[model samples]
Target: MDLATIWVTFTSWAGAYSWQVIVTLAIVGLYFLIDRLTIPVLSRSADNARLTESSGDRAVGLARLLTGTLCALAMMVVWGVQFGSVLVFAGTALTLLGVALFASWSILSNITAYFVILLHPTFRRGTFIRVLDADNYAEGYIADLGLFNLKLITENREAIVYPNNLLLGRPCVINPRDRLRGVGKLPPLPPLDVVPNNE
Candidate 1:
């Protein structure tokens, strides 16, 4: 095409989509900035809550998911996606996802349990805990609270990857003791509340 024709097409395209471009850029930039700030704050919050380092990481992951979803919705708005279409798409996607993961109900339950564990002050990293079950009992140092599981390190240094839902389901005892108490440098342990099973 001639220069005038090319110029006309370019200006028309830019004029038509300039606002979309600006909004998309703004949304993306804000998402990154929020992500950078949010992860560190969440990690610090987790640490202050005496959660495991990996739990902090899981918090970061959850933050990213929420922030990313918001960013996607903002971009969709900028692109003028219809509200009804958004609803239909979201419903269909969730239905498919639920159908796909329906057999793994424990996974969903464990994820929901993560918050329960987080809010429980007595259940945290480095705490000595015992889980009692009718069939068998387990006691260990609470190590990490993951997305789908709680990791416990036993007296013999064996790792027990307990499901989060199951851990919450069973009766738990919190016995406070420093994992490195015998070592010279570690400080004395604080008074941790013992939540006994009233069964």
Candidate 2:
């Protein structure tokens, strides 16, 4: 072969190989960026959903819902339909499911925050609470003793939902004065004189 012809053939092959390498590198860079950033950001909504209940079923249930949602979203994205093909109805369904889960969590979290802030003054921290006209009596941690209601999680794993109206009428006491109240070592309540129920 002539010297010029050989040189031309080698240059053409090198140009093609360089283009392929550039495309490959771009794909790899995108994959790593999504894995490191996108997944974590998407998973955070789940954590925000579990805003209430320091140690009760509601909190645990929220956690489970959050985990399930993140897993489902990841699966859908990974298994999404390819270009030029119709998107599956299943993908839409999964997206709706994720939205619903997030909505419910947000509503519940807001309710908990509202209850805590409204009932703050009368409801001090570390106070053992008994709800009148209710089956729940929270007594472990004054997780958040608020104005509208007293948020207490008992040692037995039950959250006592005491309303502001009820707490306002009944007298109570507290033991601590901090933002975070740990479980156990709850202060005792003064003995109340309850008349026998003549039902």
Candidate 3:
């Protein structure tokens, strides 16, 4: 057809899908906006934990994955994908969620605790920490903060791998004024005092 015929047909098609185009653009803009606002914060957190500034990419990646999923779902609705198509996978998703809840609960908890540790102002890498336990004590410097577990290096250079959640559950004493924090020559930790349990 001539240019005039093409222009008329295109206008008609655009008029029919105008709402979808507007909603899709809005959804995409919102997705990028959320990522732009959140990624810098998460990236700073990751950067602090890792000295090289590379781990921050993981934060960016995770934010992209989650926001992409949310925006994709919104776009699907705007385009009027049938509910039957969505419901088809709901059963499999529910089954997998159930298994994760029961089987990988501890793993999930540790991952969550990693975020808590990053946010906790009092505890951090290089903080001289002593965990008071009933059986024994764990005394070391907060050598490395990680996603699932923390790596502690004692004054004697012994490594203690502790799960994230259990580390948060215990009472910890942090001595920021410790002169030998990085030298691996920490002074003797004070004896633990037993608090009487009322229960």
Candidate 4:
């Protein structure tokens, strides 16, 4: 088509969807502003709470994901996408995701627990803790709090990788200060005596 024809087509298209374009831009701009305003505040809160850098980063990432998802949904609505269709698509997607995640349910639980730990100042790195499991009790200094598991350096110089989900379920006694001075030196285990029966 000629330049004049192209100009006419463009103008018609723009005229038809001008409101949608404006609304989309506004939503995007609002998301950006929220991101800019909240990120620094989240970082500072994490720092003040003595949370790990990874925790702060994860929180920021979750926030960004939420903002982006909301903005996209808003834009889709503004562009006249039917809500029923959107709901059906979202439901199907979520169902598939749920099934996929079911096998690795612990991983999902751990991620959720990670956020909980990040928000609550309970189990941070460098704290001494005892997990109250009668059969499999563990006491150690927390070396690092990871998304899936926490690294615990036992008093006996043994490192235990404890799952975040398990950590949340079990009762724990926390010593805010490192008792071993950041060393993993444990008391000696009691000697086991073996007796043999001769027939």
Order of models, best TM-score first: 3, 4, 1, 2
- 10 residues in a row with least lDDT, candidate 3: 177-186
lDDT of 1: 0.76
Model 1 regions more than 4 Å off: 1-37, 49-54, 81-84, 94-104, 134-136, 176-199
Q: All candidates' lDDT scores? A: 0.76, 0.46, 0.70, 0.74
Q: Number of clashes in every candidate structure?
A: 0, 7, 0, 3
The worst-scoring run of ten residues by lDDT in candidate 4 lies at 176-185
- lDDT tens per residue, model 3, 85-157: 7556555765664564334345656665766676566665677787756545677877776667778888888
In candidate 3, position 16 carries an lDDT of 99
Give the clash total for candidate 2: 7
- Model 2: CA > 4 A from native: 1-27, 37-86, 89-94, 105-199
lDDT of 2: 0.46
lDDT of 4 by residue, 1-199 (tens): 8999999999999999899888888998999999999889767767765766887897799878867886887787788799789878778876765664343454766766665666677666677887756445677877776667878897777898888777788888787342443333444568899788888
